[model samples]
Target: MNILLENIKILAENENISISKLEKEIGSSQAVLSRAIAKNTDIQAKWVLKIAEKYPQYSCDWLLKKEGPMLREMTKNTDIYGLLEDGVENFKILTTSQKQIIESLQKVIFYLEKQDETGRQEKNKNN
Candidate 1:
């Protein structure tokens, strides 16, 4: 069986929701996940991130790698240091994909800023 699809099914079942409902909750198109699951194919990373964001209780690591418990244990007494550590870990996990996006956005911003500067210089010249 496909592990990612199976994990999604498990999470939906645990949440007492249908696959359709889970897809809707994660802002996925209808039958998008169902088709992937049916075909035993991989899901989009965006959907995975959406699922992780929408349902924090379910472990993303488990969904991706079947590594840990499906449901992450909540700790009421989590310290600031623990939170920071978790944040760093999450950042590291996202860095590879997110860094690409960030670089692309930065390039776009740089281009736009240069265009704006050029426009200002032309305006000044005309003035």
Candidate 2:
């Protein structure tokens, strides 16, 4: 139940949508959504259908059983890096600030990788 809610939160964040928006899209009130997520009551099958229809990118298996890939399909174009790049590009079309943030994050990731490599080399030297 908590796991289902957490996955919903993750999906909402990744899609740049608010929980309110998700609830509206699924034709459920926030209170009902909360109750369903908390397992206080069983979620209706219609609600599941609404979500599956709206967010086809989510793996049904993962959403229901947590036993498969998080995404519906496995493809180079659908990898996390590809999705992140697509998100940054979409944000770039809307605002320069988003582009700057993406650039900063790229630089931070580069620096972290370099630091990791350096640490590995130092460890090898000590060995």
**Best by lDDT, which number?**
1
Tens-place lDDT per residue, model 2, 3-87, is 5556776778888987778889888878666666666444555565567657766765555545577776535443445656787
**Which 10 consecutive positions of candidate 1 have the poorest summed lDDT?**
74-83
Q: lDDT tens string, model 1, 39-76? A: 88766666766786677666666776577787766453
Please give the CA lDDT of all the candidate structures.
Answer: 0.70, 0.61
The C-alpha local distance difference test score for the whole of candidate 2 amounts to 0.61
Which residue pairs in model 2 clash with each other?
none
TM-score of each: 0.58, 0.49
* Candidate 1 residue runs with Cα over 4 Å from true position: 76-127
